[model samples]
Target chain A: MGEWSNARATSEAAGIGAAGQVQVDDDLALVARVQAGEMAAFDVLTRKYRERIFSIIYNITSNREDAADLTQDAFVRAFTSLSRFKGQSSFFTWLYRIAVNTALSHLKKSRMRRFFSFETINEEMAPGEIVDTLSQKSAGDHSAQLAELQEKLNEALQKLSPKHRTVVVLFEIEGLGHQEIAEIMHTSEGTVRSRLHYAKQQLQADLQSYLS
Target chain B: MKKRRESRHEVSGGVTLEQLLRVKRAERPGPEFWADFDRGLQQKLFKTVVDRRRSGVRNFFRIVLHSRSTYAMPILAAIMVAFGIALNRGSGDGPLPQAVTAPVDMVVSVEANTRASSPGAERFVVDLLNSGGESGNFRKVMSLGSINTPDAGSTRYVADQLGSVTGRGGVLSMGDSF
Candidate 1:
């Protein structure tokens, strides 16, 4: 297990380094073009980051429609405020901050109407082999058990407060670093780490049955 | 390595939180939905621009409404003065005749002087002498006179009526009688 983990970690690090560099370069160029009044360049930026932004918003809000609206709102705000962007941070980080703030504001306003529904995972995007391996190691139909786990995970995620949930979504799901999450949340990295710790504890307690 | 170890140690149960969260990474809208997302964002951008323009206009009016009375009154007065000046200038550019510049008192005195100087004055004096100072004959002779001798109170009323009759060139001819 340790060997497998190390190998996976090395591979992921290599992939991330290459992909991260390319994405940063592309984002910088697109942002410059947008600053120069090339609106089509913004469209490229949107396409590149829309899925990630939407996913983060979706996880936080737990409502696809609200996520879609907030995602669009975030992009629109980003476009309008592009001039103020000094490029101190990567474009994605700035965009993430916008998305996070928008989602947080929406959550605050619509606290009464907070309803969460889990979406079914697409087969192509799902880690079928991992689920199969885990399921084989246990005693259950792999797909059915995996679906139940997915449902429980979503419920557990929704049970978290917006702040903690945001940290978890950014750190665990989006695979962002603690520093990046801190920057997005506009909090200290220590606060982010603490939130992540508390959130994982709560989620672990909630999903104890499935995990076992 | 330390960060990775810390992350790994943070997981409470046997299952990693990262793996569990990864399962949900697939929970997204379909490709067709994403294709439509850009179009929707574009529409939202367009709507934002339009709303900003509308709000800008609304805010301008709002500021005008909420401004201090001291500032607002002066601005309003300036606007009214400007409007008056514009109207005055516009009237000057047209070929229309000027309004009656003569005051009613001045007009009456001028008419009296003209009547006294004309040949009609001699006839008026002869008629008055032949009437033996009778009030009815004096009124009849006064009515026969070619000049309108409106009383001080009726002067404005007569002038207004005459001004309308004469149209733009409001000249009171001496031969007019009332």
Candidate 2:
């Protein structure tokens, strides 16, 4: 059994280099090739990032149509501004910043559409029932509930300000570590921890119903 | 009914409502999710780019008009200068005008007189040199004697000097002249 385990470990260790650790690797050779005007490299990057990028937009917007639109916009903007991407950070992190700012800009423009939007949502619905409750809620209610929740989240997010939301998003949803999140957000580990702590407390209080 | 379900799940710290909601959201389905998402994205991108292009064209025209408004004085001045030159030639003002040459020098000095009441103010001998160098290459040396702060009189003085130099087809030196 020990020998078998040793063999498995050797195989896993062998998987640590270049093509083997493709997912964990942050080297954006594909992006670099795209920067050199390689359309095919860009296509590879697009395919790799599309689903994950779409997932982030979907989480924030919660509307498939809008999220998809924003995702495509994010990719196109990334493509156009690819020359400006200095690669001080990984390409993915830079792309994530673009995705977030694009989504936030969209929300800002649609702010008037968000007024009193949360009034009719059932704040008492359990986690499992929340989406279903939303789906069953009036077509108008679906939009209203989503808008309200977003407004609340935005408010809660704003309370911690820019620094905290970035850390929370990078760490919690994106599953990045303190070190990784620190690198992406460009702060020390201590700052990341403080922001994360404050962010969680704010989220817990504001999103208390969502958590319950 | 939803409230009651929500209340049941609101127990202290075990697993927050938000986490459960997240799990539930993960399970929520919109059939043909990926396909629909792709189609929607393409349409939105097309619309946004189209809108930006349209606005960009409008802004180009607006910018051109604004620039013309801003440059009306300089343009008018050039036209007037041309007209004046034509009139002067018609009236015969002593064989047109002579080539103007204005020599300038920047003087800088440090003196150790040590007689000034304020310790900060040290009297020092200075020699200055000012001449036309490429603007990009021009560097500010020691700044003393006459400092052109952004007072209105100073600004107008500089503007008049510049206008006179350009009017007489003379080059303007930025710093001290030797």
Candidate 3:
């Protein structure tokens, strides 16, 4: 993604970027229901976003178990903090902010033994054009080739520092725009772009063999 | 045909970094994982509710800090002010006493030996000044023994810090005050 493209879009539609009207409205209603002593509504919100949140944390941690644990903690924190949610931003944005912070905090606190468990990719996208092209070059079956690519990708991602990895994950993988990520990271849009640039350069260097 | 939307930046190979990294987006866990994830979440939620109940002090303080800050603010300010006052008065903080300070005027006693060396008119003036004797409250500033008078003859001369020998033992003026 071009840095100026995000900057121009954010500038054009400046002021507290609302995600989408219907989704924001639904989230607001659900949040109100949760505030009115309805635990089921919180369950609904949790169910709605748990997969996406888990994916974000999982990409950062490189461990499915740690990602699962941190995801639950993020939800619990959001539920407990529902009263203070004055709908300044969309509930979606707020929840993602909490999840990202929870993951970043866990990474900082624990000098954990690095564990990388390359889980299976989505079956639907496994036959995509990019994977197909790379698979043809490697001398192996589909499963073996996918595994090799995943290991290489994760290794390259892990080489980046946590902040830089977060930028790449949120921008490229999550498809989040600059303004939203800036808000989540509590930083300037320029900083996010810089981190993304640096992170991409580092990934390119690390995966030189695979890219070649 | 999603022609792998090209970015302006790319490697020597055809794959752009964004296009290459987008493959990671498919690393999402399948539906089966949520079965156990939901089960563990329910257990953790129950434990969190119990823990929140147990943390009465934390919630109470949080409420006090958020809602009742108007009242709490004054109390906090008062406590800080009291602490500052106590610290100021602890030690090495008050003014010195008046008696501990040096006096304004200084007096020099003229002995009989000095009078014998002087002429008669000067001797009369000196005698008149010394005649009052040691009647007033005077603090000794220094001894005039360093001057080495020809004959001391049982009379001692000294400088004292007396405000004024107005009607009694008059303080001989020495260039106002030494």
Better of 1 and 2 by TM-score: 1
> Of models 2 and 3, which has the larger TM-score?
3
* Predicted model with the maximum lDDT: 1
Instruction: Compose the digit string of candidate 2's lDDT tens values, residues A28-94.
Output: 7776665654445555676566765765555555455676678888987986687787877557667
Better of 1 and 3 by lDDT: 1
lDDT of 1 by residue, A144-192 (tens): 6556667778889889999999999887677777777787889998999
Q: Cα lDDT for residue B9, model 2?
A: 42
Error of 1 at A80 (Å): 1.4
Specify the poorest-scoring 10-residue window by lDDT in model 2 chain A.
Answer: A1-10
lDDT, candidate 3, at A148: 58
Task: Give the lDDT of residue A68 in candidate 1.
Answer: 87
Worst 10 residues of 3 chain A by lDDT: A4-13
Candidates, ranked, DockQ: 1, 3, 2
lDDT of 2 at A120: 25
| lDDT (Cα, tens digit) per residue for candidate 2, span B63-170 | 655675877666767867987966675456332222111212332122222233223432222111113232211122222222332122233334444575568564
lDDT of each: 0.68, 0.51, 0.65
Docking class of 3: incorrect
